[model samples]
Target: GAGVSQTPSNKVTEKGKYVELRCDPISGHTALYWYRQSLGQGPEFLIYFQGTGAADDSGLPNDRFFAVRPEGSVSTLKIQRTERGDSAVYLCASSSRGWRTDTQYFGPGTRLTVL
Candidate 1:
């Protein structure tokens, strides 16, 4: 693909429901990251995956949030017991090298609406 692609571009669910957001990074990208953007706020980094392992996950608010990059190319963000506060635009990004300082191409994002 020419850029990162996220599945289910939009989602609406009631509180307490579970949701999964998928991200497919550009081929050959070695670093993948996940972020969440709420209305009127900038995107907040949630997790960073280098290759097949998570490099940083401290940005996850709580146990209800998690992400995985099992094969290094595709990643998934999982949410359990979704809350109205959890509604946000989940963005995925990828970089070819130097994750800390390299340019990261962002996806369109998955809009999750928790009612």
Candidate 2:
């Protein structure tokens, strides 16, 4: 049973590029979440999924941000036309179910740097 994991840990790219950040949650857990953390601020919820469906994605900034959990265990966050403002730590987390009330386990995160 693995905890949550994210790749790269750090990503540096120019503006307008596209990047896909990955997340792997614990086995048997049906809930997954994605969030972005800017410097000096708390993590902001971007999306959360239960099973194969996106339970909530209202936190997504715009059309440029998207995510998928096709099989309900692994998730990938896709950012199109990466902007300077998009530079932040992309955190992935998971819990036992589709509720945030429960403690969520977080990944190391992928820090995106847009220049």
Candidate 3:
């Protein structure tokens, strides 16, 4: 089975531009998550999706950030009106079941640079 994967390993965009980062989870995984990691810090939870609905999105910074897992497998993180502060390494992870103790497999992450 394939591991989690993220597309556009690196992204550079000017402030106010719109960008979409993608993630593909492991086959048969039913839970997906999106996180952001800034310099010198651990990954911060952004959103979590169980199946096609977002189970928890309280970690999203603001309305500018949104994510979806329509098919319960692939997900896309969309950023609107990007800001320099939004620059970070966007990580994606998935697990077989959405449990507090379930092991999550992480992707390499998409490094986003907002200029």
Candidate 4:
């Protein structure tokens, strides 16, 4: 019955460093999604995973962003060469069953600060 969770809650890094954020989806959920929210903006989908494979990764902004869900439950979002523009709250969500469901319960989010 555990909800999705993201680690660090907050992260601070230099403009060119690498950072990894973790997400633990709820038990029994088959769909997981990653979204990024900048200041005063709606969350934008980054990537999504159905079971252990990525169902949609078109939202990834560039080569600097990537994610994986190997075991079909826990996932990690990795960013390389982090830029100042990358500073934002990275949110993770999960839902029951499959892709048609839009009810993605969210975590408190991991706030990334790039300087």
TM-score, each model? 0.96, 0.95, 0.98, 0.96
Sorted by lDDT (best first), the order is 3, 1, 4, 2
lDDT of each prediction vs. the true structure?
A: 0.94, 0.93, 0.96, 0.93
Residue 22 of model 3 has an lDDT of: 99
- TM-score winner: 3
Cα lDDT tens digits, model 3, 1-115, are: 6799999999999999999999999998899999999999999999999999999999999999999888888999999999999999999999999888999999999999999
Q: For all the candidates, what are their Cα RMSDs to the real structure? A: 1.0, 1.1, 0.6, 1.0
- Deviation in angstroms for 86 in model 2? 0.3
The residue ranges of model 2 lying beyond 4 angstroms of the native Cα positions read none
Give me the runs in candidate 4 sitting further than 4 Å from their true place. Answer: none
Candidate 4 lDDT, 1-115, residue by residue in tens: 6788889899999999999999998888899999999999999999989999998999999999999999999999999999999999999999987657468889889999999
Off by over 4 Å in 3: none
Better model by TM-score: candidate 1 vs candidate 3: 3
**lDDT: worst 10-residue window of model 1:** 95-104
**How high is the lDDT of residue 77 in model 2?**
97
